[model samples]
Target chain A: MSTRIHRRRHAKNIAAQVLASAATLLALAFLVWILWETISRGLQAIGISLFTKITAYADQGGLANAIVGSAIIDAMAIALSAPIGVMAGAYLAEYARSTRLGATIRFLNDILLSAPSIVLGLFVYVIVVLPMTAVTNGTTTFSALAGSIALALIGLPVIVRTTDEMLQLVPSTLREAALSLGIPQWKLTVQVLMRAAGSGILTGVLLALARLSGETAPLLFTAFGNNYMAFGPLEKMASLPAAIYQYTNDPNPALHAIAWAGALLIALFVLALSLLARTVFARGKTSHD
Target chain B: MSVASVTLDSNRGRDRTDARNDALFRWALRFCALLVLAALLGAALSTLWGGREVLFGDGWRFLTSAQWNPVENRYGAWAPIYGTLVTSLIAIVIAVPLSFGIALFLTEIAPAWLRAPIGTGIELLAAIPSIIYGMWGLFVFVPFMAAHVDPLLDASLGRLPWIGTLFQGPPLGLGLLTAGIVLAVMIVPFISSVMREVFQTVPVRLKESAYALGSTTWEVAWDIVLPYTRQAVIGGIFLGLGRALGETMAVTFVLGNAYGLTASLLMPGTSISSSIANEFNEAAGLHRSALIALGFLLFVVTFIVLLIARWMLRSLQRKAGKA
Candidate 1:
């Protein structure tokens, strides 16, 4: 009986090992396939003209305007979210501590962190875009500002959560030393605590930007994708993800090629940002924490 | 006043200014923190207010009806809701076991040199954006599936009872199954990473004792590590489920966005997020409100899933404390 039990367990172990290895291989293979597909198709479609002009007409268009538009939108979003996130994080660490309101806000923010980006876009559309159209007598104008608002909403929770966690990691002894110097509360926070936690907070900001830049759903309802080189915030703006979305939806092969190129650009940009953020924060952790 | 008295007055005045500055700054920080909460409430309130037109205009029929005609101003959410649930369920089913296997492989079996690099590479998967996943799903994955896997399923069991119908159809490749598979791929990193973390938290002593009892690697993983982290593992699954439910771009590309109910996973269908994404732009007046209402519904579903997940996590912490 003992021998039989031992043999059965041995077989089970081998089978389990096979299953585990297969899963890992599948996962790794899928990753390679995606990167391979994006690069091969996207690289071929890239051209000097692709970055120098607005999408001229269908198969003739470049991604210049879309790239610029994404930059403008994400910059605006970071500008809006970072200050608010940083200050709120300070309050959570410095003042509120574990107060009722702080805990509640933290909980809700955590929910919003995982909330669908499209829903936030709808919220912004209902609040900003739709109302703006109604006030303007229905011209159907999709603006960079509206896209920024949507992106900001999507990024807000990420920044707040990161700021809060990073601020907590700043040691309490640092705060006491700053206070001993008779520094004002704001100065203590800005000069001492923030300096100590700077890299972690910056990591959070970069990660948020990385997250907001790839968002196509929210931009669909807000930016709505301009086909020309529009420069105004109130003007409809083209974005790389939106461009990719539209191009792939088109039945033309040339359009599909452009979409692939746009996908490659967005993927590389986001990947680089995240890797940079990770390395920066990982260095901070090893050097300090 | 004497010179000493004059200097004392100035010093006192400076102290007062500093104290006031501290108060003002403290209050400002507090207000900023309040803004985060305000934004959360504002989103929920505005979504509710925007959907007031739909909520009152259509009543419960919005949830019950299957017909969606924006020109005629009519809508029903049953089909999209069903699609969302089914796709998420498919994702969880495909992802859970695979995530467990990968987690076990990383924690219990992998060689030391390969571990860190493999773990880091797997996490790089999260850095790829959802829209890119959508693009890949549309351009590469769809064609691959339509060419190979769909035909195999059709030739084999496309004639059975319940599940056979799921494999029925011309294998267009843009359907529920494709969306589910894509979502499965997207969520693997999340669930597997989380599972690996949880599995690593199992007590070293417990694992060592199990090994000493002549238990094989698989037995230790299945009988020892599995039971120890079961609740935490479930919580990780729910986290992935929450993501799958609200996933928009990737699912939108592959889900085909057709509005009908069938057991056929091969059939084209629409999810709530995809419905909102596809129609929210051109949808005017009532159609617009209905789409916002859909967004609201998606929010509620994901919110509930997250809350349950949090509850599970809290319980798991308690379980760990007792252990």
Candidate 2:
């Protein structure tokens, strides 16, 4: 009787295992389906003119201008955010230790980290765009500079948190050795500690860049959409995300196809960034080990 | 004596130069830190100031009034507020159980070889952009819901008194219900992954003890794993809630952006983000201020919720440390 019961129990366990595997496979299949659908639809629109020409009359536009605009805005955001994010991270990790201020900063940082992108856009609109409109002359409008600034704000908390965590992961023994050499605390941080944490910091920056690159909500109010390519930082510029939004709404099927292509490019960009970050961090870990 | 004096003079010069360099570097680092603090402060203060007019001017009336017309100079955010809350609540109700079940399955039941690929697949879902989700929802998911899911729900549940009212609708493809479902899909991966991580923190010894006692896998999970990771699981739920609340583009596309409340989930409604996205460009005068006020309320709601989640997670971390 005991043997029979044991056999029944083993059979039930095996059934459960099979069911679980089936569910996991279903979930993975769903992901692959989405990816395949996106790629197939998106690839149909890619062409030579897609990379070299500006947006033309309604149906025949390429993404050359949008790509340039996105690059410029993202680059500016990174330039503005990196120094501040890294320094704040350094303070949180090295200076504050476990003090009350440190705890407060950490908590606030986490809140900022999770705060919604739409709220950030709203904040910028209320604070920057509306005020500028109220005070300035005629037809005050959104600019690429304003958009980049908002993106920088969105990127800031992620970089700071990542940098802090990575720096903290550096063992205290390294710090002690640097101190024992009679180097100042600041020098130890910049020369020894930061060097050790360099790859992690780079990964964090890359992840931040990946995140902000796809943001559409914040730019809506800050950059507004432009049809023609305007190279000025102060002018309205076309970004891949904003272009996707506009083209998706267009009545033209060709424009809709272009939107798919734009989305594919954006996805590819994010995927590359994440893969780069993973590679760097993996190398860093192996080296440390 | 002459040799000793020469060495001492050189050492003194080296020390002076090092001190100067260190001082400059420290000053620069401190300045940068202050600038970061300033940026945070600026973001907060400007949001507050920009919305201060509406916040202080009509205060309570601003929230209660339902009207939102720009040309006639009347404004209210009740519809948007209601839409945001209802959709998010619906999303959480559906998502929590599904994610929890998936997490349990993955951690306690799945075979070893199946785990890694499944985990990676779920994480990849989190990586997909909101815009792509919006596009997919617009073209594919909404039509599917309208054709199949809505009809089924109406046919089955339309007779029950309370539940019947919820399903009663024109079966339009885009509405609050569709938005809520999309949100559930978007947030599932985040909640499940966090729950999985927390479950792994449960000590191996505890599981081994349960196994030795002949406890079933489900029994071991219910008795040991659930209790061990309860706090973290709650934190993970709140994190998912935060993401759902703030989700914009996908919600914008499917929500239909109507400015009213209705008993039927099939009717169109507007969220804070969707309203802002749909109308911010054309708004002028007090209309802009009112919209900004709506944005302020959203910020406050999300900020408080996120703060609470952070506090919960911190306490959970402390408890884990003690254990």
Candidate 3:
């Protein structure tokens, strides 16, 4: 009787392990399906015309305008965010350390980091876009500038948190040695600590960029997505993700195909950036402990 | 003596300049840190400012009413609010068990060779853009569900009393159920990753002692690991809830963007993020303010959910530290 009970218990253990593993494999199968569907269906719409023309109401053209617009907005967003994010991160890591102020900033930054992109879009629409439109005499405009600011807000906390975490990884021993050599706190952070944490910070910034690039909701209210190719940051500009959203909702099969291609392009870019971040971090060999 | 004094003066002058530069640099970083504070303040203030018209102009009926006519300037958010809650609740139901299982597999059962790569593959799903998920859900998953899954559910569970109404609708390929499932798929990675981290915090000694006492893997996991991480597991579920609540594009594509609320999950619905994303443009005056107000409400809800999750994790950490 004891031996039979032991066998039944052993069988149950094996069954449980198999069940858990099966669950994981099932999850993976879904991931595989999504990738497969994206690549197979997405590739059909990719061509030179996709790179050469502006989108239209009737869905005859490509995502060329959106491509340019996305690049412009991304450039502006990165430029606006990088310096400030890095500086804030430096303060959290080196200057404030663990003060009450630091703790408050950390807490707020955490909230900001995960705050909905749509809410950020609403924020910018109220503060920047609406006021600017009113100022421009009801031009019905949604400038790329407004979009960039919204994207910058989305990326800010990500970069700050990454910078702070990366800087925290720099050893206290290093700080002590540099201080003993008469290095000033600010100088030590900028010249010594920043250099040590460079790769990790770069990884964080790149991932944040990838994240912002795919954001559609925030740009919907801010960029407002122009049909025509825009010239500068002052004008409303189309972006790939917004284009995808618009086209996907349209009844035209051609537009749906275009949306698929756009989705693939955005996904590829995001995945590449994520992989690059991992590679850079691995190569840095920095102190994770 | 004169040469030594001159050298000392030069050294002191250089030190003074260094101090000045240092002060400037620290101030600059501090200023940048304050920019984030300013932005956070700006966001909240703008929400309050933008929704000012809705709050004061429309009065309290905006919360209770269901009519949202952009043409007529009559706005109510009850449908979107209801939809967001119900869909997120469904998502939690679908995601929590799967995430826990995935976390367990990764931590306790996955092979040494498979662990890192599998872990990475799962994390990569989180990197997949929400828009892509939206597209895929619209084109592939929804149709697949409408054809195969929904009818099967109807046949199996729908024939029963009381449960039939939930499964009675013609699977139109996009609705609350589809949106909830897509959200569940989207958030599984994030929740599972959190779960994996929390599970890793469970000491090896306890698990090993259980094994030495001839505890089956299931017995050890259930009796030891589950009790240890119960708070954190709930926290992970809430974290997933927060993501589902705020998620825009994915739900927008699959939720059918219906204007009204309904009893059945099979029927179409609208979420706060989706409603705003769908109608914010050309939403003149009161309509626009209403959308912004909707966003504020979403922000408040998500903030509360996140705080609860954070509290749970903090308590778990304190217990872990003490133990």
Candidate with best DockQ: 1
Clashing pairs in 3: none
Which regions of candidate 2 deviate over 4 angstroms?
A1-30, A130-140, B1-41
Write down the DockQ of candidate 3: 0.73
**Could you tell which candidate, 1 or 3, scores higher by DockQ?**
1
Best-to-worst ranking by lDDT: 3, 1, 2
Per-residue CA lDDT of model 2 for B1-323, tens digit only, reads 69999999998887788788777766675565555556556656666676666768878878877787776787777889888988898888877776766787889887789777778777787778888888777777789888998888888787688889988888787899999988887888888888888888899999999999997776677689989888888888888888888888989989998987788888889898888777877877677777777777777788777776777778878877788
Greater lDDT among 2 and 3 belongs to 3
DockQ of 1: 0.74
Q: List model 3 lDDT by residue over B1-323, tens digit each.
A: 69999999998998998899988998899999998888877877888789879967877788878897777888888889988988898888888888878898998888889899999988888888899889999999999999998888777777778877777677787888999999988899989998998888889999999999989878888899989898998887887888899999999989988877677788899999999999888677888889888998888888788777777876887787787
The weakest ten consecutive residues by lDDT in model 1 chain A span: A53-62
Provide the TM-score for each candidate, comma-separated: 0.96, 0.92, 0.96
Which stretches of model 3 miss by more than 4 angstroms?
A1-8, A286-289, B315-323
Off by over 4 Å in 1: A286-289, B1-8, B314-323
Q: Write the per-residue lDDT of candidate 1 for residues B244-308, one digit (tens) a residue.
A: 99999999999998997877888889999999988887777888888888888888889888777
Give the range where candidate 2 chain B is weakest over 10 consecutive residues by summed lDDT.
Answer: B32-41
